[model samples]
Target: MTTVGLLYPGHAAEDDFPRIEVMIDSDIRLPLFHTVTDGDSRGVEALRAAGEPERLAAGVEELRMAGAEALIWATTGGSFVRGWDGAHDQVAALARTAGLPASSTSFAFAHAVRELGATRVAVAATYTEDVAPLFAEFLEAADLEVITTESAGIATADEAAACDAERVKELVVAADHPDAQVVLIPDNALRTAAYIPELEERLGKPVLTANQVAVWEGLRLADRRVWAPTLGTLFATREPPPGIDEHRGIEVRE
Candidate 1:
């Protein structure tokens, strides 16, 4: 069994990990550890606090004991709000602390975009108007063109988690662009795991979401490529995506 540790922020939508684990029908395990956040707010300060070393260290210890071969920080806002360099540093430090390969959701999105060989992407974010641009910027830093970004102005993870499935679908539809190669929903708090197939069918394009990418990132770090079509295009094939060796943020220690 391949085990991946998830250092999640707050309590919203974390169930997506286990849902994915079951859907994959493989020995892939996603064990989550909820990290402390400052009120689970979407503000920059709160996001930064969520990825703090102290909070992540605690989660890392728990997951290591769980036999996690790799670790991921499963929050888009918590990592991207710090900008590109900060996010890289965050994962780098996480790797050092855990003595294992580590990555975050922000980097996961960038890597997922490359894995799909997509150049342009549209973002459907649950962050506030002020916080949404940071994700676009983060994508741009990875050299992927951001076609457009639409924000839902959700103030906190609690608010995002409470949104119904139809509302989530509406947000994704509004964010799609004819020019975009993929549609990205970049909030771990929002529940998009169950709607990936439906949304991708409606859009006729790949749809990448926060929790989905986080799980994929953990597998990538573990050098585990799995075929899970229900999870969407990212996991539909076991073949290596283009640039698989390019821009992997840390050295995965065995």
Candidate 2:
């Protein structure tokens, strides 16, 4: 079985590990590390520390020991809050430290959108409205256009995890614009694996959710593109990518 390592935030993203495994019939192994964090006001320290190079290197080592062929820093805010350059450097440090292929959910979202041939996107985010703009800016920096954004104003990881798919769908469809080519839900805390199909069908466009794209990114790193379809058009549609260089990171594909 192909093994994918994930540095998931403590108190967040617990269900995603199983969601990916169950959603795909690839028989892959997901080894998770509950990353060290202290949730404080605005989660400033927690997010910053999660991307710290020294700390991330250690996380990569732990996953390496578990035989993970690829790694993902699976939190959205922890990566994007740093902006594009910082997010790129964070994954570079992980790849360098572990001497393995690496990617982050932030880049995964951007890469997924680019793979779908979309320029304009609508975002439904679980971050506080104040912080949601950072994600929009991150996407813009990655060269995607932001058409609309809706934030649920959720501040805590636990609350974000507690969000059901139906509520999330409501937020997503509400945020979608007539001209948007895709709808993105940008909170790793959410359990979005099972909702992508219905959401996409309803929106008449692609829906890229945090947990779904995060798993897809890791699987792509492991070179397991056609793992059998479950939800979303991605599983049914994406062809094997030209390999991502372990040193160069994921390509901003055409």
Q: Model 2, residue 113: what's the lDDT?
A: 80
Q: What is residue 70's positional error in candidate 2, in angstroms?
A: 1.0
Worst ten in a row by lDDT for model 2: 245-254
Predict model 1's lDDT versus the native. 0.88
How well does model 2 score by local distance difference test? 0.79
TM-score of 2: 0.90
Residue 127 of candidate 2: its Cα lDDT? Answer: 81
lDDT tens digits by residue: candidate 1, 1-254? 99999998889988888788888889988988988777757888888888788888888888999998888989888899889999988988899888898999999999888888888999998889899999999999989999999999999889999998899999999999999999999988888888799999999999999999999888888888898898898889676565664456575453
